[model samples]
Target: MTNDSPKPDDDAVRARVIEAADRLYYAYGVQAIGMDTLRTEAGVSLKRLYRLFPSKESILEQVLLHRHDMWNGLVERAIEGGEPRERLLAIYDMLARWFDEDDFRGCVFINCFGELGTTTPRVAEIVRTHKAGFQARLAELVAEAGGPQSLAPQLAILAEGAQTTAAIAGTNDAARQARQAAEVLIDAALGPATGTAQTRTSTTVTTARPAFRSRR
Candidate 1:
């Protein structure tokens, strides 16, 4: 794509604003930045900022969308060059690299979920769609790789939790734990022989373990 930046125009100004906003959110936190600061950083007038993003919430939503696209591209590229089982590992491998990055701050969607509040349903919907797509992709990869059918969803949940936990922990050690847990889950769900996945179901009464309660 040709450069849309460095021009004294709307797209240029907006792109700069977005880049600054991205940096602010990644460096600080989403709620920490405001429109005025972003405008100043972009060297654009208030009118231009509004013309680009309408509102602070709108800008934040775009920031999330930007993040989603970038990450999705990474995932798609990884998925493109792997077999089903290898593709599953590709996700973890990607996370491993991300965890090693000094500025890594976990999943942006999760962070945005907390920053989002109840501003716009549309923004919320976008976030939900991204997450749902990721989980669905995980499920598909698991099925393709011959993992246990019944546990795909459960494993997805576990992976999300691990991502959140690793972000909070902000350490390579935490990421390693997530990776190992993923392997164990996969091992328990070793490749099925049949062409289709076999889902197991059983009725059992069980109490919730306090350790397993959601932190959110």
Candidate 2:
């Protein structure tokens, strides 16, 4: 006689593990969290967890992949239904909202890179791929906006720097500051012929720096 019982959904179990790992790894460095903690956090039996992911590294890899999908979706939603210029600026708008979140930590890729990139080749490669993907997306946006390809890297740098600065400074002001600088860069790239009079005027004014305070 064969006993029939419903088996757990592998996909759902895998997603739970990845989601739990993402949160745990983000809050605590990946190396600090062990498989036992992950299993508990995921609310999965150790046997099931091991069945889904043989090792912590495997779980981390899935988490990063999930994060990549999330990040891409976020950018797509932020830039949707906007003109090319608005789409470009919308990136900063998205950043501002993200930075204001109570649980806001730095970029997961950057954080993970700092933690594991040196010892783990795969983590480093995933980070590099994620960044390159963003830069490529920016290049497409710049091309659509009639800005030179060179402008995309500059904008990407500003966005990257803003993320680091916001994380370190513990303030969302970096987004506004980066957005101001981006406006200048965008106007210069598009030149006076294409730039709006308002943007042209704004570029001439000096932007005041925000005062720094230690979050610790």
Candidate 3:
């Protein structure tokens, strides 16, 4: 059992700042957004917002972390309820909706890195760490699907590429096409193991629920 007590007020304020930053960064490129604009957009006072994230780059780190966690949570839940092949396909299905947003810019991690280019060590670290986790989980799922070690890295590249194309092409259909291509790649790599994958698919008005959370 767990008690869901409210966080201390300051912590809650900081979380709100991070959420606002995430929304802004997702809709607009990080370089295009400034702290004053963020203060106005978040409706938090300059003094208070600074207390939460001392710098815009700091806010960038939080934004990336929050979105990466949310993405993992959604995918983990989808994978749990789906079969192996379905689980593999679920990754793209999760990305597809993001492309439909009016302000759809691109995959945040890749986008941020492209802009930063290792100039900010902390921000760079956040992207690398988040992506490493993605690779690790993807590898595990690939192995579970009875794929070779090579297949995990290969599938990860495809997934990342799919997200890139969706953002670049500015259409939902691009992602679908990429997913189909990835499925073919996975099939060729795994042989008979392909059919043994997914057991179910998601059909709903609701977003896939988060399957995991931190102890905090």
* Top TM-score hit: 2
Model 3 clashing residue pairs (backbone)? 83-198, 83-199, 84-197, 84-198, 85-197, 85-198, 86-198
Q: What ranking of all candidate models by TM-score puts the best one first?
A: 2, 3, 1
Candidates 2 and 3 compared by lDDT, better number = 2
User: What is the per-residue lDDT of model 3 for residues 1-216, given as tens digits with 9 covering 90 to 100?
Assistant: 223333357677777777778887777878888888888877778976766566777677667767877877776766665556667777777778767878878778888888895787666777777777787777777766666788777777877887888888878887687678778877787654444454323332223222322223
**What does candidate 2's lDDT look like per residue over 1-216, in tens digits?**
222222558778878889999999998889899999999999999987877777777777878887887888888888876567788899999999999998889899999999999998888888888888888888888877778999999999999999999999999899999999999998898853343422211111111212222211
lDDT of 1: 0.67
lDDT (tens digit, per residue) of candidate 1 on 16-113: 88888988887777778777777887788776677667667767766776777787677777666445655666676777677788888877777777
Better of 1 and 2 by lDDT: 2
Candidates in descending lDDT order? 2, 3, 1
* Candidate 3 or 1, higher TM-score: 3
What is the overall TM-score of model 1 with all chains considered together? Answer: 0.76
